[model samples]
Target: MTLPTITATRYVLPLREGGSLPGVVEGNDLGTYVIKFHGAGQGPKALVAEIIVGELFRRLGLRVPELKLIQLDPAIGKSEPDFEIQELLIRSAGLNLAVDFLPGSFGYDGSAGNPGDQAMARILWLDAFVANVDRSWRNTNLLVWHKNLWLIDHGAALYFHHSWMPAEKFATLPYDASDHVFSIATPDVPGVDAELAAAITPELLTEVIGLVPNEWLEDGDRERYLDYLTARLDKRSAWLPGGAR
Candidate 1:
């Protein structure tokens, strides 16, 4: 599926809370988005993870903001006082990853608007499947908007791709969910695993990964992701939080 592309008309403000220095921007579509720049500290790989994992989450029927390929023009940041942000905008003056901005969203406090046990189980299971290490109490990476939980900031997921090691080597690695934001109590992990794991078929993975822009992936990287995720799903017994059912 091709993600909708929009040109950024203006850079509104920087979200300094993010290590990579993402920012709010107004799009030609007249929509607001949180733009994740390619020039960020983590580079384009983080944007790749964001698209792959975010789209996968959406396919799994989870709440995630609509993602788009935003065309950024560095001239939009010319008037910005921050030299650092100006430099970043200059370097990222091309296609970048962005998500629909939630107008009144608040950081999830882990209590309000709880999505119930089953949904929480699904969320935890997904993180384990992708080997995501960012969704912890320290940085929930979750937002509560309009009384619902919305997942975000998946740039830290699929850490195995950061190296040249064989993807199969990371397939059997265990995920430690003890630090997960929703790890307070055990959810019906096996039940959720049974339901969700079947949904991650190779076809679905291909579609999800296809949503990533071609420039984001290098040669063979596409097949490598497919193979890694497929293998990981097959070897879930080693990584599922509560062990396979």
Candidate 2:
């Protein structure tokens, strides 16, 4: 597949958690984008959350940003001031959101309200399976674009990494990865319906995944993401209604 390429010219400013990164695009090629890193010094599992579960969302049919990894030498960012694009999604306080654990209930509002329950239910199920505890309306993990809802920033999935496990233990997943609650052919959930799950596509998964930058997984973890996504597409995709069958 032909993935979009970008070059870093200037370092963007620091974002939430005080981690600074660069914002870049196809340098001189004409396009707008915001690039970010997993973290400082040693990378964190949050990067895994973004790549792994982000792709999962695509497979389950969700709108997400075209993301990628860009490399900005520490010298460039530390020496210069970079502008980071503020995420369009935000809480009532208007703070940037990070998915890792919802503080409380913060559902939808207006003619498009019930999203809180339906979407939240699906997300809760996904989190239980992947061990993701973050993401919720309160934290603004959900995005609003042209009156449509979208998922973003999955930096805290597969929380089991905190525990030490034998290789065999890792082989047999301890979580249930089912979408029965939000099937493409099940009862409706008030404002939302199972129809939404049907939107997932292999091409869309491939496409959004194409946005992940090499720098983000700079330490060979990129291969892990590629393999994780590919394997899930073949393995866990069945959890998605109309995913394979």
Candidate 1's residue-wise lDDT over 101-193, tens digit each? 999999898678567888888899999899899998889999999998999999999988889457667788998989998774345788888
TM-score of each: 0.97, 0.52
Q: lDDT of model 2 at residue 164? A: 32
lDDT of 1: 0.89
Q: Tell me the spans in candidate 1 whose CA falls farther than 4 Å from its real position.
A: 185-187
Residue-level lDDT of model 2, residues 134-223, one tens digit each, is 453335456555566666656656554435343233333443434222232222222232343334354555555455544433465444
Could you tell me the TM-score of candidate 2?
0.52
After superposition on all C-alphas, the RMSD of every candidate to the true structure, in Å, is 1.1, 9.4
Q: RMSD of candidate 2 to the true fold?
A: 9.4
Q: Which of the numbered candidates is closest to the native, going by highest TM-score?
A: 1
Note the Cα lDDT for every prediction shown: 0.89, 0.43
